[model samples]
Target: MTIRDRTAIVGVGTSRFSKAPTDTPMRLAAQAFKSALADGGVGRDEVDGLVINIGWPLGVDYDRFAEALGLRIRFADQSWTHGRFVGPTLQHAAMAVATGLARCVACVCGVSFIQERGLLGGPGDFEGTREEGGTHEENPVYGLTAPAAGAALSAQRYFALYGATSAELGAVPIAFRKHAALNPAAIMRSPLTLEDHQASRFVVEPLHLFDCCLVSDGAAVVLVTSAERARDGARTPVFIAGMQGMRAGPDEFLFATPGLGIGQQREFRYTPTEEQLSVYRMAGVTQKDVDALYTYDAFSPLVWFVLERFGFCGLGEAAAWTQKGRIELHGELPMNTSGGLLSEAHVSGWNSIAEIVRQLRGECGERQVRGARVMQWATAWGDSTIFHS
Candidate 1:
């Protein structure tokens, strides 16, 4: 009756990361879904289950998406997952298939974060009611104006605490761009070096332009079904070994409001360490079993936080660990083989999961982690998953 080993991700599809404005969100969703269907050898009519995310400005509800895709799904759910809540929607789709609520399920998302799409706005715009002067009083007084600035504050603390140098911090994006150079689907495949990363302008203090993820326009979809059914698909199935979602309280490090004493300090719970350990226990595996790592790298400092939280390194040791080339493609633990959100595309966390499925199926040609049997995808907020072939 457990969700473990009950269902498999049979197919994955993704549109090329671009800024040329090719299609609407619905059309993008349909394109990715069709590609996934072709990959799985499943027809559109066979899909009776669906899971969709309704991120602000990327609004494609379940019913409308179903209509657009010409699907009549019996089990459909909509979500608005951000940060650590990425994997819940996918897990719901898997559960539906496991319980026989539907046979084949399509999990899809279409995102366009470009200015021309009319989705642009200042920070916290998605939260609504951001009137000019009325909301200013309660706003934190510290420089937590945006995610990048918040990350900068965190990064400054990390550097001061860990004695990490700017060169060490610059290595993360350098490695990501190296990986992106090998991925044709990646948007920023141009060469990037440590020197280049260092020379880039600071979006915020201690965080450079290269350290941030691309603002992308693309769609990605994955098809899930019973393991037995997946055995008959066009490609190998990547089984969902385990998944867990974790969150922090408002008083926690990452959630602390600016202008408050707690927020001004260097204490942020960027990683849910205990919850991550619990997920490992639930999966009955340890970090030693993982063949590759896919972390949500919206900011490069996030990679450092992930490494330490996931037990790859001890507290304040991620910078030194990266300096040793421990996370490169040929290093001890290869990370972000598909370039992640940093270089591949930022469709929330969907692109990262798609890369995980591909690696497990042994579909990645050059950037492949050889003998990649089991892999982990972790988000900055705490959503984590383990997949295997």
Candidate 2:
């Protein structure tokens, strides 16, 4: 019944990242799907399971992807369009293979953030309304709205409580921009300096434009199959060593860790205990064993929240922790070595998952985490999966 190391990610593929709507989501997804099949040396007929987190407007649904990609999937699942679903959806793919629901599962996400598609704004906009938003985030009741409000709310609170300034927050994107400069597929590769971050106009008060993720078009796919099948395949396998489900409730904030007091979340001193972050226990390792860390960096504050949520550092210590070269390549704990959602194209965080698989396989050319054996995909909202080479 153990899921650990039973299902391995053997193939990873991604389409070009762009801010322009040069192609459709289905077309982009098809490109990535074929690349993944070829990367794993597996045939299109071998994929029988499909799971997608982003649907419609921002990306394609499971049925559209399966039908358009000519995949005959016996198992399929799709969820609301949000970055929070990335970790859960990937876990579902591994569970499918482990439970024999499908032999090989393709975790797919094709995203186009271009407004020209007419998928965003005007009643078609999916951003939470005052009904759902008032409870979870700060959103306007009129005009076009986005998820940035929630991130901005979280960042403002972190700055006030910990005395961390926006200048300190700039470090997260500054570091990722450095990584993006090395990645050919990244859309925001221009060198970003702290001065540039400070000078950028505010998207929402404390959150400058650079603090938020890019609105880009791209697709990424990761192929999951049993460890036994991977052993017989053409590429090296990156085992899913451990997993912890996404957390929710009155105390959990989508953009902040527990007890940070955003929305309905209660205000208190939050600490990440061993029993709370069981991914490490399930993987039979500790925080010190992780060679690299990757997260859903839709905003700079999320990087700080994820560090505290995962116990990489104490609560409120992330502002100081992320400074220096700590989170950069070859640092104490390299994070988002592929620029993540902040600098890399925002493909609903699937790009970072693809990066994790590449790091474990030693496939990343310049942005690789040297000798990386164990890499983790975690989020500020509290979902995680640990992988090992």
Candidate 3:
């Protein structure tokens, strides 16, 4: 009954990431789709299923994409428009392929943040932030607002509780920027220093401008199919070894670890139990087995929280754990080696998924993790999928 290793991500593709809008979502998606088909040695006619994470006008819609790509899709789905839905969208594709509802499923995301700034969370938008409305994270009537405010609140509390500092937080983006330097497609590849991070202006006091992810335009495609059929693919197959769904409730926050006191999250000493972190149990692996890690790094603080949430390190230890090149390539736990959302363009975290596929295939030359047999895609929001080559 277990779905573990039942499906494999056979191919992945992505468009050039840019800070400025060059092509429409459909145009970029078309390019990435063709690339993915070629990479997987798959034909357009073979794709009978489709799943989308971010939809129009922020990205391409499912119905329009099928018609434009000329795909006769038998199964199709689209998650709500948000960065957090990337993991769920991928898991759905794997489930569809494993249960025989479809032979192959193409998981798609083509977003243009540069084009749709006012649609979602941003500075001074028209649809005044409110509880469970206007992006669901904002409640401006009570001075609780989207994104930056929530992250900053958690970071402040974490710092107060654990003695962490913004300078220590610099290590995350700095590590990712180092990785971005090796990637030709990364938007911000320049050398980043702790001093640079410390000096950067604060977007939401206690959270520097560098702490946020880039607002960019791009598309990425990942093809999912059963493991039996994946063995016949052109490139190596990266098996989806395990999965855990997103968590929610009074104790959970979309941007903070459980019990961080953000939004309605309750405050408590949150040291995750083995039962709380089922991804490791489902994957048949431990944190020690992970050669690399990837996450939706929308904010640098989220990186710290994800590490603690996943039991990679004890609560309040990520700030210290991430130091001294521990997360860089060839380090103890290389992460986001393709630069991630901090330095790499944010295609709603799909860019990092494509990076994971490339890493497992040994295709990434300079930034490749050595002996990367196991890697994971997880997020601070608490969804995860473990993949192995």
Candidate 4:
């Protein structure tokens, strides 16, 4: 009767992090899909369901991808959320299998964001709309074009309220980049310091260039099957444990609203803390039980917010936690051991799932955290948040 204990990730795969050349989105998807199949020790014919994120620049059609991959799929669909879609996709796949709608599900996403012909460039040009319209465009015009801007504003507010410094924020990117230095698959592997982070160009005030995640061209796919059938597959099975998503408000402007006097916004939630706490409680695990952490680091401040939200530290105490080296490898809680999107290439947060699988399988090379039994991965897009364990 418990959904958390029933689903397992049997296979995980990803393309090398780099720029997409002449390859089309479908081809990129095929490569990732094949890699996942090979990793899972499952054949393409065994795949009964397919799910894809429709947020990338190349615009993936579920039917087109299934046909091109030669998969006879019984269930196929596309996700709407941006980077936060992966967890939901996995949830859907698990339900499909658990309900006998499909036996094996392949979830995939391909990004051409780093290419010259990418979605960041324009719309219809890509799968999603480029121009921010309706309530969505409200904040972007106020200079919140990218996610970092909104997060930076939050960072500013956190600092203003807690007396935290930018140096504390710098520690996250510095640590992640250092970890990436050891990860061969990472794109930004150079050693980083608080000085380096402070010196980096300002993407948005309070957020340096290094605080932002890279927009890279790549694709990643994972295969999900029944937990009972997982042991027969290629790799160790990482159980779903639990998954949840919460939307506090619509559009990006909600978080960016400046407080109007003492108690103007009494019910407004400024961060993803409540949603994250709910997921952790639902999963029946504590932050102390987690061996590793992979939070969406599209902006550096997010690390702090996640740390507080997930009960790693008290509210307004994330800066102290980072300053004490609690989040570094060999520390109490190692975070972003795969370099995360901050140091590793960003594939719309799919890489977070791949990294979690790698840690669970004990396949991560130099950046691996030893004896990692449980992991926490989170994603945030606009006002929506998704967490998986």
Candidate 5:
């Protein structure tokens, strides 16, 4: 039986985001998990499975975390994706429930990098290391160190073809920060101007400091149960309608190949736009049905790339759409309603997932959108992509 319609998210919770935390990662995760359980009207004893997106500088292990929580888990495993683990984790939890392996599954993500180091230096330092034995080190060494650098390459190519400028890229972070200003949990909620984005120092050429996301410490958790049981619990259930993941090839192969960039790429190119379309197809939905969007914004350029990839607009037209305030809270599509990674504290994009849940539940106090039925969340890791609805 298809798991697409079998599971629903009944509980979602998150700790306040911050660049530096006075609390530990485990404590943050525990708080979020407890909040989720309370939101779902379930007890910790009812959680049959525990899933964590593990990998951080805090030296916290999954086994240790489970032990600390005192959960007698039947299924316990950690996700390996750097920042793109949220969607797949939810999908895996949904599958577990659909297949009778679990009744209630809890997925948690925690980050304390900012508490360890400031914005310029933290968690991302060990991004591409090999644990046992591996040899895929070329692309990462050549300045594709983090998601921001890799996305900058795509941004440069996008500008070349679409005639978009760095200023257009500036608008994404600016818009997100504006929304974040209303979120008390956000770290950089102050008003930001295009001049601020253009004036920020460059982390990578064409990708300014403001264009990149903040390194933060926080935790978020979600509870998934069978769709049949979701409405029996707290709040309205948001069904897990669809999900998909795709990988093209090594980063160099997709980036260096001729006719692979934005407008220059061949029809149905191996770009973000095509990847998003493939996800929409898998979800059995259309762009018109997507009332809200939470595209990964580790970097500002990713916003445009994902918009084009999901067929929201033609290649290179994302900048125009964004500039026209079409993505603002009152625009054609309200995006990043919870401030997003750019302005809100970045908990490795886990906060983005929580924001999507809030939008679906109509719980967003200031940045809430009306009639938000369908929402899309996308994340790109290395050269792989994952999407959820």
Candidate 6:
């Protein structure tokens, strides 16, 4: 279905992003959902559809949540395919509202410390799974079973190909930390220096501890409604201008796993592909038209890789581009104005999306982009969405 301007994100809200959140997942989600409703000037009875995303060890039924909220919805779903379901969930809610299957839909997602710590036991505990083989089955031999191992390998290969230095890679975290300093909601608000990023211990060689995202506990909820309904809402509605989702391709896997040094090895990216060009075409916007950018940054290199895939710069040039300060606020294009996943909270990309809404609505005080008209959000896993006020 054509998702261009059919629905609007009328309200956005987020719970505290922290390492030690005391509320249960359900309670946290409810708090954010209610805040979204209030922001939209919507009532609980007005909601006709519900969507929820939860991580491992904290699975909550959508139906039960609807019942608890006293919402009799026409449709409800739990989106938990992988950890990267935020983009897809938003797309699903937009389609529902556009097609009249639901008048108003709430997309809620959150994770708790219990899940991150693996306090509640599952099939195999978090640490025990490391000994087992990973998806490739040959991962254990290379000691590449853990995610950081793959990231480290990718960074090494990327640096070798582009002659990018670790200090150049440090620029990513530095810019994010600068933006985070302006955001009161960000967990890592302390001033950060490139020297500090380089001095931090390496989780995997070339990937420092500062390069990784935090294990945050929080919930974020967004309310989507038809354009007509949103026009009358309390807050200025941010339209869902366009969306595109894609996955890894043969070239991507080859680059990630260059056996015998033979594959499409030139390019290095967090995901195998970027399907954002089509989204921009559908929305009738261009890279230059975007007033602000939010790229998913679970790791620092992700910003560089995705910038290359999205045609923001040539492959291997992202390091130099970042060093030039194009990503900081008041630059050519401000990025992660809310600190992103690296310094901000990592509720997947939910908080990033919220920042976009706030920016478009002129709600962001110190970090606000003046007269921001269009904002684009890209996930590390080949999902992209654009929003405009």
For all predicted structures, in order, the TM-scores are: 0.89, 0.96, 0.97, 0.87, 0.87, 0.89
Best by TM-score: 3
lDDT of 2 by residue, 1-389 (tens): 46889999989889888898879888899899889989999999999999998887778898878777788999998887776799999999999899999999999988888743344334445454535653235455743255677778888898899999999989899999999888888999999999999999998789999998888899999999999999888889999999999988999888898998887889999988776799988888889999999999988999999999999999889999999988988789989989988998889899999999888988889888888999899998788999998
**Candidate 1 local lDDT, 1-389, one digit each (tens):** 35677899989888767866777777787788889998889998999999887444564678888887789899988775343345777888888998999999898888776633332324444432344211211223443344566566668767776688778988888888778888889988899888888898988778899998887788899899999999989998999888776545444344222112234334443443465566677667888999988887888988887777667777777888887667878888888988878888887778888888988877788888888898988654456778889
Higher-scoring candidate on lDDT, 3 or 6: 3
Query: Please, what are the lDDT tens digits per residue for candidate 6 over residues 1-389?
Result: 57798899998888888877678777787888888888889988899998876644553467777877888999887764234577878888988998889999988875774455443223333432556444222254554444456556667877887799889988888888999999999999998887899889997788999888777778888999999999999999999998887445544431132221223334334322334468788788988899988876877877876677666776667789987778888888899999988898877778888899999999889888888999998754466788999
Predicted model with the maximum lDDT = 3
> Which order, best to worst by lDDT?
3, 2, 6, 1, 4, 5
**What tens-digit string does per-residue lDDT give for candidate 5 at 1-389?**
34566788888888877776668888888888888888888888888887776555542456777788998888776776355566666677877888889898888887786665432222354534445211212144344445455566666767876688998878788889878988888899789998988888998788899988887788888888888888798787877777775334323222222233422345334444454356565557787878877866778877776666556776557788898678888888878877888889777677877777777888888888787878877543322222233
**Candidate 3 lDDT over residue span 1-389, tens digit each:** 78889999888889989999899999999889888999999989999999998997789999999999999999999987788999999999999998889999999988898898766555555454443644545556656455676778788889998999998999999999999999998999999999999999998878898999998999999999999889999999999998999987888877788877877777887888877778889889998999999998988998999999999998889999999999998789998998999998999999999999999999999998988899998888789999999
Cα lDDT listed for each candidate: 0.75, 0.87, 0.89, 0.71, 0.70, 0.76
Residue 65 displacement in candidate 4 (angstroms): 0.6
Clashes of each: 5, 0, 0, 0, 3, 0
RMSD of 2: 1.8
Clash list (residue pairs), candidate 3: none
**Which pairs in model 1 have colliding backbones?**
84-381, 84-382, 253-268, 253-269, 254-269
Off-target runs (Cα >4 Å) in candidate 6 are: 55-59, 113-115, 119-142, 253-276
Quote the lDDT for 125 in model 1. 42
What local lDDT does model 2 show for residue 299?
86
Model 5 residue 79 lDDT score: 73
TM-score attained by model 6: 0.89
Higher-lDDT candidate of 5 and 6: 6
